[model samples]
Target: MPKVFGFAGYSGVGKTTLIEQLIPRLIHSGVRVSVIKHAHHDFDIDRPGKDSYRHREAGAHEVLITANRRWVLMHELNGEPEPSLEAQIQRLSPCDLVIVEGFKRSDIPKIEIWREANGKPMLYPEDKNIVAVACDVEIDCDGLPWLPLNNPDRIAQFILNTFVHD
Candidate 1:
């Protein structure tokens, strides 16, 4: 199975920024990485008036937009049901790592990004899945590994060393 890690935190806590930084580092280390981001809103990947959007509105279950070097398969579900993280991972095919940006309540392990200025709570002290914290605060981590908040490369290396290597 491909290795999995999550970047989770309260809204506006810089979780996305941290993930953005980590991706390049992981790639440079020769790990093929995929990401599954959870959203709380009704998101749309196909824009209106576009051919892909029209095809989906015409009852297409899946639409593939292909180019010379890229392809995107957009699947339309009939209802709003959250797929299991494992199921999502399966959809990504073979990869060295899958870094998820949500599913905080799920069983998957995570790196909690906490910004002290954001006034958000620490996910580590309560969630056992939170294996490490990337934070700007100096609060006691209760012995959990703490990576500097602004250093994405270091956090990525830490993840590779701890989880991906051995």
Candidate 2:
């Protein structure tokens, strides 16, 4: 099983930006990483009336669209409850690490991105699962390691060092 860590924070707190930057660094560091992003609202990757969407809409439990270089899979479960985080991780192919962008309430380890401009409370100040914080403005970060929010390479390295070993 791969180690799972989440980049968690409120909206506009740079979670996506940090993950976008960290992923390539992790890849350069020779770590195979898979990402799972949790979306609150409904989303459609295959547009309406598209072949793939039509296939799925017509009761295909799993529809996979393959291109020369990549593939997209949409699995639909009707009345089957959402799988657990562990189960979801298992469905993905093996990787050195798994970086989840949301699912903040799960018990998995996480790095919280906090931007002062967002005016959100510190996730770690309460959530014990938050291992560290990446922040914009420096404050007394208590005992947790606080990294500058701008440098994704450093944060990426920290994540690999703390969670994954090569």
Candidate 3:
């Protein structure tokens, strides 16, 4: 099984930015990484009038678009219950690690991204699965492992040491 870790935080926090930085650094270090980001609202990769969009709109449950560079498979739930995180992870191709963004309530090891300016309470206090935190400002962590939000390399190293390496 691929090692899984997550980043969870309130909106306006720099979770995406941190992940973006970590991906390149991990890749450069020769680690195979894949990311799964959760969308809180409706999102569409296909544009209007495109054949894939038209097919989906016409009630196709799944659409596959293949090109020279890549391929995308879009599956429509059509009111079905959203798939569980475990189920979603099972569908991914093999990799060394899977970095999940969001799904805050899931029972997976996670690093909570925090920004004091967001005025949000710390999630680590409430979620036992939260193993560490990354923040822009030094805040009381209640003894949780902490990393600087500005240093993606160090953050990446922390992740690799904690989860990817034995």
Candidate 4:
């Protein structure tokens, strides 16, 4: 398996935005990046009337949809316990890096995104797995490195420097 790294933050802290901008930079550097984002509530990639949706609604446990450009596989948990992060990662095709957006409590190394406007409590203070902090305004990062949240190139470079050492 490729190395797994993550971004941990509260909702609305720009974790998604950061990752979206950072992915291309990593790819531009010739690194293939895969992302696994954890959602807190029920989410669906298929619409209600789609064939994939119909198959899943018809009690199919798995549905595979393919197009000329891409393919997707949807698996129904069917009341089973949610799989661990590692299990989900294992299902992804091989890549140079895995940028996880949630699974905050997992022990995988992560960069904590923070913003003063969010008013949410800081997570890195308690999360030993957090390797760095990316914040909007100046703050005392103490021992941890503080990355520029607005500058994705620098953030991408930092990620490459710290975690992409293959």
lDDT of 2 by residue, 1-166 (tens): 8888998899888888788888899999899999988888777788898999889889999998999999988998788987778888988998989999889899998988888877768788888999888888776678888888998877887887899963
Whole-model lDDT per candidate = 0.86, 0.86, 0.93, 0.92
Candidate ranking under lDDT, highest first, comes to 3, 4, 2, 1
Q: Weakest 10 consecutive residues, lDDT, candidate 4?
A: 137-146
Model 3 per-residue lDDT tens digits across residues 7-101: 99998899998999999998888889999999989998899999999999999999999999999999999999999999999999999999999
- Write one digit per residue (lDDT tens) for candidate 1, span 57-141: 9999899999999999988888957678888888897998898998898898888888888876677878999888888856578
**How many angstroms is residue 118 displaced in model 3 relative to the true structure, after the best TM-score fit?**
1.0
- Candidate 3 Cα misplacement greater than 4 A, ranges: none
Clash numbers, per candidate: 0, 0, 0, 0
Model 2 lowest lDDT segment of ten:
136-145
Q: Which sections of candidate 4 miss by over 4 Å? A: none
Quote the lDDT for 144 in model 4: 92
Which runs of model 2 end up more than 4 angstroms from their true locations?
none
> How do all models score by TM-score?
0.95, 0.95, 0.97, 0.97
For TM-score, candidate 2 versus 3, the one ahead is: 3
